[model samples]
Target chain A: MSAESITLEELDATERFLLAIADDEFVTGQRFAEWVTVGPTMEEDNVLSSLAQDEMGHARLWYELIDHGRDLDTVGYNRRPSERRNSILLETEHTDFGDTIVINFLYDTAETLVLEAVAETADDAVGSRATKVLEEERYHLEHATQWLERLVSTDEGRRRVTASFERLLPRSADLFAFDAAVGTAPSTAGILSRPTDELRAAWRETVEETISSLPLEVSADALEAAVSEPVTNGRAGEHTDALTALLDSIHAEGLPADHPASGYHA
Target chain B: MKLEERIAAGQLIESGDELTDEYRELLCGIIQFTANSEFMGAFAESEWIPRAPSYQRKLALIAKNQDEIGHAQMQYQLAEDLGRDREQMLTSLLAGENGFGNAFHYPADEWIDIGLLAWMLDGAAMQLQHSLMKTSYGPYARIMKRVCREEEFHIRHGEHIVREYATGSREKQERLQAGVDRWWSRAVMFFGLSDSRSEKSERMDELGIKPKTNDELRQQYFDTYVPKLRNYGIDIPDENLYYDEETEQWEYTPPDWEEFNRIVTEGGPETQARLDRRRTAFEETAWVRDALEAYDGTTANRFANNITA
Candidate 1:
C-alpha cells in the first residue's frame, strides 16, 4: 500500500505524540506499581495498584494507535534511548507514595492540557485520538486534584507538597518543547494550533487559575511566559540521575532486538 | 473449648442488647484504638512493597501489606459503624493524637526485619487475633477471622526468609541474626509489658476480647519459639530467656514497655519522614482532586449516566 493512502500527516503527528505520552505513562505507571505490596496502607495499595494498571492501560491504548505492526520485542524494548521521548517527569522514581502522587498529578495535568489542545486540531485522526484521551484525562486530573487538596489542607502536608511541586513545576512546561521529531514549528509549517509556547501559556492560565486557591505560584510572575524554553529536554533523552537509576533497576534484563514497535494499543 | 464451638457460642453473646454506657465507652475506645493503630502501621509497612528482595518475596510482602490495609479497612468500618467517622480516625492518626501500631513506627531497616516481624511480631498479633476471633464484640471478631487467615501466610512468609538466611552462607546467617537482634527487643515490647500489674490486661481480659494476659502470652511465645530457635542454631537475643517445664511456659527478660508506649505515641525514628512523604503527595495532587470532584458533578456524572443508559 502507498504510504499517503494509508496514513494522514495528522495521524503521523498523533502517532509520534502518543508514543511519547504512552511511554511517559507506562514507565511512571510501572514505577508506581512497585508500591503495590508496599503502600502505606492496604487501602492505598489497592488504589495505587489500580491506578498503576490504569496507566498501563493508557499506554496500551496509545501503543495500538502507534503500532506500525513490527514485533513488540524489537521496537518496544530494544530501541536505543534516543528514539524514546517520554518526558522526564514520569521517569524519575521516588518510592515515597507522596512523591509518586505529586509527580503523577503534575504530569497528568500537563498531559491533559496538551491532549485537549490537540483534540481541536483540524486533522480528523489527530482530533479523534485526542478526543479519546480527553475522556480518560478527566479522571486522571480528578484523582490528582483530590490527593493534592488533602495534602495542602494540613500544615505538614502543605510543606511537603509545596516542596515537591516546586521541584516539578519548572519542568512541566517542557512538555511542548519542539524537536525535529514534532515536525517543524507551527509558524514555520503553518499548521493550526500546533503545540507551541502559546498553547502552553493557555494551559498555564487554566491550571494556575484552577489552583489559585492553593499556595502554589510559578517561581516568578514572568515564569508563565519565560519558562517555555525547557531547562532540560526530557523528550530528547536527557534525564536526571534518578531516572537513570530507575531504568537500570527496572530493565535489568535488556530487551531483544526483534521486539514489536512501541506504541499505544486499545 | 473447641475452636468452632467457642466461635459459635461467642457469636450468640456478640448480639446481646446489654450495651451499657460504660461498655459502649470501653468498646468504642478499643475499636478506635485498633483502627487508628492499623492506619499508622499500614502507612509505614507499605514502604517495604517495592524494596522486597525477591520476586516471590515481593508478591508475599505485597499480599501481607495488602491484608494489613484490608484489616485496617475492616477495623475502620467497625469504628465507623460504632459511630466514629473516618475523619476522626484520620485526624487522630495524622495529628499524632492516638496510638499507632508499634512495629510500623520503626522502619523495616533491612530485609531481615521483614522476616523477624512476620515470624515474631505477626506471630504475637495472630495469637491475639486468634483469641479475638472469638472476641465478645461481633464485628471486630468477624474481621479477625478473615485477618487471621491472611496472618497465617505472613507467618509462613517470615519463616521462609528467616530459614533461608539461617541455612545460607555465613553472611546470610549474620544478616539473619542481626535482624533478629535488632528486632528481638521490639518483638518482646510489641506484646506489651509482661506485668500482671497492668490495668490493660485486666480490662481486656474482663471484656473477654483477650483470653490471656500479656505475660501469659509472652510465655506462650517463648515456649513456641525457643525450641524452634535452638533447632535452627539461631541464638535468641535474650541471654536470660528460658522455658520452665513445670509451668509449661517460657520466660525471658521483659521489654521496656515505657519505651514501647512512648514510641507508639510520639513519633519514632522514621515517623516524621514517612508522614512528611504522605503529606507531600496529598498536597501535590490537590488540583487533580478538585478537578475530579468538580467533574464528578458535571461531565463525569453525565458520562456515567450515558454509559449506563
Candidate 2:
C-alpha cells in the first residue's frame, strides 16, 4: 500500500480528492479574508488574517501536488466555479462574526478529522502533507473552539451561534459528500487507510461532544435535524449561487496575464 | 545629566525611567502616531486584499498588511511601556481624536493606487524609519530595525507591481500614470512640513529621535524615486519638480500644506469612513474582550487557590 505502489488510476483518484480539499481551503480562505481590516478587534483581525493565509498556503500545497504539467495559478484560477469542488459551507458569505465562528468551528473540526485520517494513509506524500496541514489545523481548531465557548456564554452570543448553526449545518453535510470516483477509489485501494465515512463519523462525534460541553442550549436533536440533508453536495461539483458570485468577484478585476506561472515565492 | 546632554553624548535612552516628563510625553506621542499610521495603513490596504488580480498579488498584499499590523503591535507595545494604554490609543484613533499619517487618510480606490501605496507611500515610510533606526529611544530604535527590514520587502513588492503595470498594455500604463498623478503630492507631503515650519521637528532633532529633517527626507525620497519613475516613462505630477545642482537637492512644487493640515486632522476623503469602521469593530467586539477578561480572572483565582491548598 505504499505510495510507490500507487497506480496511475489510483493517483488520479487521489488527485481529485486533493483538488476537492484544495478548493475548500481556497474558498474558505477567500471568505475569511473579508475580515482583514474589519474584524471585531485588531488582535482578532490579525488572528483571522493569519488563519486565512494559512488556509491559502494549505490550498497551494495541495494544488502543487496535482498540478501535473500545469502551474498552480493555472490549476487554481483558470477553473470555472462549476469545476470547483469546495463545500458549499465554505462558499457562503459570513455577514456576522457569529456565522464566521460557526463556519470556522464546523469546517476546522471536519478538516482536523479528515487530515488525521489522511495522515495515517499509506501514501507517504499524502500522509506527510496531511501531517503538516494537521499541525496548522490544530491552532485553527483551538482558535475556533475557544471563541465558540466564549461566544456561547452569553444569551445574545448563544442566539447568534445557534442561528448560524441552523443556517449553515445543512450545507456542511456536503463536507463528507466526496466525489464517487475519487472518494471510493483511494479507500478501496488502501491508499487512504481510513474510509471517508469513518472520518465523517469522527467529525460528527467531536462536533457533538464539543457543542454539548458548551453552556449553550443546543439540543442533540437540533444538531441532527440541522445536518439531516445534504444541501448542494459540493464534492460532487454541485454548488450554490455563492460560489459563482465569489468566483465572479475574484475575477472582477481582470486576471493579470504576466503573473508567475507556478506560485508566489514569498 | 540633562536630556540634551545625554543626546549630545550619543547615549541611548534605554527605558521609560530615563525619560524626563517632557521627553516621555514627546516620545509617547511620536510612537503613538507611528503606531496609528501602521494601523491605518493596514486598514487602507485591507480593502484590496479581496480584489487582488492574481494569487501572487493577493498573497503579497496579505503578507504586507500582516506586517503592518505586526509593526503596529510592536509600536503599541513600546508606547504602552511609556505609560500609554493600548486600548486608549486605539479608542483615541477610532474616535478621530488622534492623528495618523496624512497619506493614509485618502482613499485607495484603484489597483494602481495600491501599487503606488506599496511603492511610493511605503518608500516614504522607509525614509523615515531608516532615519529613526538610530533614534535615541532604545525600544523604538530596536523596533525600527525590524520594521525597516520588512518594509524593504514591501517596497520591492510594490515596485514589482508597478513594473508589471508600467510594462503592460496601453490601458494599464495609463492607469499607472493616473495613479501616480493622484499620489505624487501626497507622497511628497508624507514627510510632514519643512523644518522651519514645525517646532516639533526641531525638538525631535535635538533629542535624536528624528535624525533627518522633513525637507531632507523628502529630498532623499525624490532623489531615489524621480529618476526611477522617468525611466519607466511615468511622469512626475509636479511641473516644478527638478534637480537643483547648487543645493545638491531635488526641488519640487510645495505640497498643499493647507490640505495636508486638513487631512491629518481627520478631514481627508476616507478618514471618517475609516474611523467609523474601526469604531464599529471596537464596539462589536467589546463583549468578547469582556468575556476574555472574566475568563482570565477566574483562571487566575483558580490557580491561586490551588497554590493555597
Model 2, docking class: acceptable
Candidate 1's error at B70, in angstroms? 2.5
**Lowest-lDDT window of 10 residues in candidate 1 chain B?**
B300-309
The per-model DockQ list reads: 0.09, 0.30
Residue lDDT tens for model 1, B1-309: 532345346542444345555555667776666665555555565565544443345446655655676677778767666666664565456666766557767887666777887887788767767777766777677888888888888889888878877887787787777777788787777667666656755665666656666677666666677777777788888888876789766767767777887787686887778667656555544443344335345432211111100
Instruction: List model 1 lDDT by residue over A38-142, tens digit each.
Output: 444335556665566566566666666666763333333334454556776677666344566677666776777667666665367557766776787677677
* Candidate fnat values, all: 0.10, 0.30
lDDT of 2 by residue, A127-244 (tens): 8889999988888888888788767766677787877877787778878766443756557755466776777778888878887787666655657744555756887778898888
Cα DockQ of the candidate 1 complex: 0.09
Candidate 1 positional error at B86, Å = 2.0
Q: Mind giving the per-residue lDDT tens digits that candidate 2 earns over B69-94?
A: 87997898788778877777887888
The whole-model C-alpha lDDT of candidate 1 against the native structure comes to: 0.61
How much of the true contact map at the interface does candidate 2 reproduce, as a fraction? 0.30
Stretches > 4 Å off in candidate 1: A1-26, A33-45, A53-89, A92-242, A245-266, B1-18, B54-60, B195-200, B264-267, B271-309
